[model samples]
Target: MQRSRDGRCKCLSKVGLSWKGSVDEDVVELVQPLTGREQFFTASSCAGCIILLDGGINGFEVQKQNRCWLLVTHKLYVKDDVIVALKKANGGAVLKFEPLVLHVQRQQLQDAQILHSVAIDSAFRNSGIIVGKRGKTVLAVQSTHGLEVPLSHKGKLMVTEEYTDFLLKISKSKNGGKQEEN
Candidate 1:
């Protein structure tokens, strides 16, 4: 009754935030339908993307927060983009492809699970509900199609520029295949 059990309503927060900085342009079409529904509000989303970063192998994993993001783009990239980013790396450089991801906050746990089922059916196999302290319920939807390749090591190019270009093309093709479902 007090706005919500936690004195917070994600729906209202979404409304309060301006569209310009809150949601990615490419993701609007996919989340638009759910936005109008009473039980759901989009918390965040990304259509798909490729990222070029300078990172280190910290205890067998890439320290995402500590890495330097050389380049990031939601649209398909060109060969020149990768070439420029590689020149800036002082350590290891990794090229990664990230697939579509969306987080929908639901009014009820049941509603979150219902949306989760649909996400899984639509090939977002990694979709799951996130629950924690407070009454918030969120459904995280993600596709399993993602790739990461090491492009450099010790500030030296590990793979040829041609190979990196080929990787971008492959990642772009994956995005094309996923878009058809939405």
Candidate 2:
């Protein structure tokens, strides 16, 4: 689980937004316009996950960090320059890129459906949008493709580069087309 400050995320505070850290930079860029319409609010998110352990492939050791979320978002439009600041803040703690996952709270089933449609349209590929208690709908959106590797190895940064490029390419490809527009 990621850390939250007074029921808010510290990441949100660093960017000079509201105290709640419901959304991070990358997500803000991806969903700012929708948020402005008050259709939904993000509860928590994991842009990706990373874990660091002391063991290699041969054996096992203590896990330094277990399932840490790289980014979390809410509703504020606090952009940290495309998550560059968050990455920089991560320092050398990150070890892998897990699938992007988001938990969102929507106003209605229609809003959730709209978000689900947008998420699938954006190539997320794996989304579990369900109606929770009290008319609140939650969406768990995840990406099928991601980079997973130990940072101890050399050239790992190259893998990160490649992964980032891949995500951008797919996102752009999905956004540039009108498959459902006819």
Models 1 onward score TM values of 0.84, 0.47
All candidates: CA RMSD in angstroms? 5.1, 10.7
Worst 10 residues of 1 by lDDT: 12-21
Estimate the TM-score for candidate 2: 0.47
Give one digit per residue, the lDDT tens place, for model 2 in 62-128: 2334534444332122233223423433323233334557776566787788878888998888887
TM match of model 1 to true structure: 0.84
Model 1 alpha-carbon drift over 4 Å, by segment: 1-20, 177-182
lDDT of 1 by residue, 1-182 (tens): 11455544344246422223466678777887886567777777777888888978564466568899998878765579889989999888888898887888778999998888898899889889999799888899998888888888868898987788788888877776432211
Best by lDDT: 1
Cα lDDT over the full model 2: 0.47
lDDT on C-alpha atoms for all candidate structures? 0.77, 0.47
